[model samples]
Target: MLEVYIDGATLGENGKSAASFVAKNKQVCLEGYTFIGEKTNHEAEFHALYFALVTLKHDYSDEILSIRSDSKIVVDTIEKAYTKNPAFLSYYNKIAELITHFPHVFIKWISDKDNKRADTLARTGLQTESTVIQSCS
Candidate 1:
């Protein structure tokens, strides 16, 4: 069983956007970042999920996964409690596509405070063009 925590950050005016992931036992991180040129916070959030899932797919072939994030919309959409907005359906669908590969997938929501490491990493990724990625490979 593996647990993952992820988060994304988007600054003002294509300033910076990043996705950061932390796996169980505080072992390494899987992180990514890009200059959005111009995008919204919501888009960054989706990017976070996208990159996180992709990382999981490449890193773990046949393992059940549990993903945690601080994004309520992401959690709710995955849980089917809230309807996916038409504007975001495409991105959501993309996310859903990758999720199908997992034997079991769980998305959980936690407070921002509890997710500080991932959040900070996301912000750091955005600030630095280096695109920091740490993971126990």
Candidate 2:
């Protein structure tokens, strides 16, 4: 099983958003953050998961994936099969699509204390001057 933890941080003063993720027990895995330009905190949360999923799908297509996120909004929305905000529909749909590629995918909400690594990576991503245009894995 592939275990992934994801998080997103937004610099409210500059309107910059960044996302990060960590894959546990993978020798060569995508575990970093990238500047995603301007986005709301909610959007960034979705982006974090989206980027991680895209990075893992091609290589771990048949593997069981367990994704954890600190954002309750993202986790609840995905798990409940509904979104209250129309602005997030595209992101929501994209996540749903990517989930289909995995033989088994489980998304769960975790406490911030448990997601420290990803949270730190996300904050560090906001401090970087450059944006990553491609997958770093």
Best candidate, TM-score: 2
| Whole-model lDDT, model 2 | 0.84
On residues 1-137, what C-alpha lDDT tens digit does candidate 1 reach at each position?
56778787877745456677776634443444443334567767767777777777876746677888899887888788345477568778888888887888888999999988778777777777556555444
State the TM-score for model 1. 0.82
What lDDT would each prediction earn against the true structure?
0.71, 0.84
Candidate 1 local Cα displacement, residue 48, angstroms? 1.0
In model 2, which range of ten residues has the least summed lDDT? 128-137
The pairs that clash in candidate 2 are: none
Q: In lDDT terms, how accurate is model 1?
A: 0.71
Q: What lDDT tens digits, residue by residue, belong to model 2 across residues 7-102? A: 989978448999888876555455768889999998889999998888788887888889999999998998997997987889999999999999
Q: How much is the lDDT of residue 103 in candidate 2?
A: 88
